[model samples]
Structures are given as structure tokens and as C-alpha cells.
Target: MSNVLPRAAALAAAALLATTGALVGATQSSALPMAPTCRVADLELAVGGPQRAGGAIDYPILFTNTTGHNCALRGYPGVSVTDARHRQIGTSAIRTGEPISTVLVAPDETVTAVMRTNSRSVAPNCRPKSTYVKVYPPNSGVAEEISYALRVCGMFEISPVEAAD
Candidate 1:
């Protein structure tokens, strides 16, 4: 019945409770399901206004989750130039130095991948103009036709999908 015994017991009980909580949290999170890969049909693609800097044009391509559920996007989105008829004009885009990782996209949330190309002002022929840009979301065979009239210059460097912010 001493005060020392009661204090020691209380501390031990607190420690046990904390340890139990940590284990329970870990187990529950491990049991949680992960989002499936994003399908091209469920994503809405949009291109932001182009910004020119350092003789390079960076196009921010946005992929928004149009569905109510969550999905994931990993790696670089295949980007290529196209004409009015949706013909691929050049080789697929080369991956830039951006680290490739999976991005969990919530419903109505947007992720972005920046396409960088040499500015037409630097060399018109080197950066031929394209009437449209065909973007294939990571791991998607189907492509989306986005109105991207620009001098994309044969699929320039592009980064992997990341948070739009």
C-alpha cells in the first residue's frame, strides 16, 4: 500500500497500453487495402498553359481522377506528338531525372507530369509543330488526344507523375 508501489504500477500499465496501441495500429494499417492502378478511361487529362524558360518549354500535363474511387499512377506517362489524324509523329518521350514513384490519386484530385521540349524560337525545324499531343497514362495502352498545338520536337524529356502541387 506504499505510494512508491502505486506509482510504479501506474507507469508499467501506461507502458503496456502504449505498446498495445502501437501493435494494433500496425496490424490494422497492414490489413488495409491499397488502391488499384488508374485506368485511362477513369482519368481526365488536361494540359496547363505552357511556360517557356531557358530556351525550353515545360508543359504541365494534368491527370485527374474522374471516378469516385481512388487509384494509383506510377512511372512516366507516355507522351508523343500527333497530327489532326492522331498519328504519332515521333519517338516516345524520354524519361527525365525525376524519381519514379507511385502516386495515389483521390477522386477529383489531379497529378501532373511536366513535358520539357526545346523552344521553337531556338530552332524551328528542330522543334517541329504538332497539332495534338497523345498522352498514355502510365501502363495504359490507350491514348488520350489533348489539344497541344506546339513545337514538341519529337517527344522531348518528361518527368514521372507527381502531386500537382
Candidate 2:
């Protein structure tokens, strides 16, 4: 009976540790493996909602997980404006915000990064306007192209990936 009690206590302690690790969202790989980083091919990308207000054109670049398994995303996605011929039109988007958290995306779930850019009224001649936004998902070498129609100028800033509410 004494031996069984000690073994049970050890098992309970191990379970508690595992649950706590999940709750804290530790970046380090636990004994249980963490979800792999999301791949570009595993996602459906879209440039959504260019909400123009005042002097700014604001929008969200959305990433939808298409796979059945959960995947992880951290840090900023690489973003650049590209022309119809798939040539990069300008410098890559600058990242804004701090303290990004890892997001575990489940099947069909979406995450977004808000973008802010100059309005047409704010920058008149950034013309031959960009036709699309090129996206490289975090840690991915491959890219995804999404439709975008905007004349981007000045500092184009993007926030970190966040879970869609």
C-alpha cells in the first residue's frame, strides 16, 4: 500500500507539471512536443478589409489554417507589396508592436496582423499601385500571394500575428 501511494503521488505531480506548462505557454519545448510552426502551404492567405479612415489606410492580413492538426505561429510574417508580375514594389513591411505571443491555430482557425499604411491623400504618387501583398509565414521560406490594391507609401507597419476573436 505504501509503495502504491508513493507511485500515485509521483504520477499526480507529473500531471500537474504538464498542465502548468501548457497554461504558462513556455516557449521552450516541453517533454511533450510543441506544435510545429505553420507552413505557408498549410495556410490560406487573404488581405482583408482595407478600412480607410482619416489619414491612414488600415487593414488586416489574415492567415487561415487549412490542415486538421494544430500549428504554431510566432513573430511577424514577412510582408511586401508586389506588382501584377509578382515583382516586389517596395521594401518589406516594417514590424511594429512588442512582446508577441505564440499562437496555436487549429483547423479552419484564422489569425491576423493589422497593417497601417499611408492613405492616397497622404501620398499622391506611389503609383502603378501595388496589386498584391506577398506574405511569407513565420519561419517559412516559401511565400503566399494575396490580392491587394493600394498605393502604399511612407512607413508601412504591421503588427504581430494575433488570434481572431
Q: In candidate 2, which residue pairs get closer than 3 Å at backbone N, Cα or C atoms, i.e. clash?
A: none
Q: lDDT by residue for model 1 over 56-164, one digit each (tens)? A: 8899999999999999998999998887887777776799977888888999999999998877676466644678888999989888889978676433888999988
**Which residue pairs overlap in candidate 1's backbone?**
none
Model 1: lowest-lDDT 10 consecutive positions: 23-32
- Computed on alpha carbons, the lDDT of every model, listed in order, comes to 0.83, 0.83
Give a tens-digit lDDT track for model 2, residues 1-165: 779998998888778778775533345543334688999988999988888878888888899999999898888888988898999987888988656888888899999987888776787656468888888887789998888886776668888898887
How does residue 108 of candidate 2 score in lDDT? 97
Candidate 2: worst-modelled 10 consecutive residues by lDDT: 23-32
How many clashing residue pairs appear in each of the predictions shown? 0, 0
